[model samples]
Target: MSTLEIKDLHVSIDTEQGTKEILKGVTLTIKTGETHAIMGPNGSGKSTLASTIAGHPRYNVTSGSILLDGEDVLEMGVDERARAGLFLAMQYPVEVPGVTMTNFLRTAKTAIDGEAPSLRHWTKDVKAAMENLKIDADFANRNVNEGFSGGEKKRVEILQMELFKPKFAVLDETDSGLDVDALKVVSDGVNRAAEQNEMGTLLITHYTRILRYIKPDFVHVFVDGRIAEQGGPELADQLEDEGYDRFLVKA
Candidate 1:
């Protein structure tokens, strides 16, 4: 079984003058087929945590270990980590002006999976995933995220996730700026991908409404760059009722 283990992880971004720390000794674990929700307010190092795990070159891991199925992911490069079955759905997907969605997805599929998809099945699969996510069929022909709505961008990420079928996925604030209907569509895409692949996920978000649909197996309260509390599905209920105020006090 695939498992992602973070042990006393620390991350910092560099500046010309000196270094600044973001993630301070954070530790967590996600086993195969488990859905773990991490809740934190802004600047709590949530995105930093996800970026660090995916081996983002800009963020440096000062001290800690990232293990995938008992292997050290820190030793691997970004592509290596991705090919090893770790996926990050970024909070902000980049806009690739000249790269069409179909081309981008196909290239990523080929590079990570080590085989280009056959034309016969590739077109069919792409269309089916778009249909599932309610993305227009023409989205495939557009530049990657160049003219997408917030919801469309999230769905594009999920589409890549679906194509990759990574063993572990970290979804960063997939619920942001989405309308009720768009929210359902995005949540459904994530659910479908997880159910189809038994993919372990770490969903980072502020609102609990998404949880109403996704139903996390575990909910963690992150504050001051570390997890202050963690529990079963009930924790999400508590957050929904009380909010993060008590968590700040506890932290």
Candidate 2:
């Protein structure tokens, strides 16, 4: 089984004020089919961890080791990491003005798999996935996330996740701004990906509502630049009842 390991990760980013350290000695391990939820307040370096794992240019890893299935992932570039079975669903998916969803998804799938999928099966698969996600058929013709609502853009991200079928998926605040219905749809899609594809999930969110649907195997409470606490699903319930106030104090 594929395993993604983060050991003593330290990351920083350059701001106008100067370099700011975000993640300080964070360590975690996620194996295929395991869903690990990272719960934390804002500015706690949760997204930073996701971006770092996905090889985002903004976050600089001063020291740490990110390994995927015993291979050194920190050394791989962004596209290289994706090809190595790493997927990141951003909190705010960007718009690609000229790229159609069909073209973009096919191109990305081709890149990750090292060969283009068969056109007939590919088209059928895309349609089936879109239907399962409750996305309209016309969505394939639209430019990538162009003029779409927040929920629509998020759904498209899940669409890619379903199609690409990565070994590890880092979902950054996928529950953000989604309504109950939309949230259920997206959450169901994530569950499908995890169960069917056996994708290792690092779900980063502040609220436990999403956890109610996704049901993480482990919960890690991130504070300041480190993990302040971690436990089973019950920990999420505690956070919902008690809140992050105590964790903030520790931070």
Question: Best candidate per TM-score, number?
Answer: 2
State in Å the error of residue 49, model 1. Answer: 0.5
Model 1: per-residue Cα lDDT at residue 72: 96
lDDT of 1 by residue, 69-91 (tens): 99999999999988999999989
Q: What tens-digit string does per-residue lDDT give for candidate 2 at 24-47?
A: 999999999999999988999999
The per-residue C-alpha lDDT of model 1 at residue 14 equals 93
lDDT of 1: 0.89
- Name model 1 segments beyond 4 Å from true: none
- How big is the positional error of residue 186 in model 2, measured in Å on the Cα after superposition? 0.5
TM-score to native of every candidate shown: 0.96, 0.99
Candidate number with greatest lDDT:
2
Q: Report model 2's TM-score to 2 decimal places.
A: 0.99
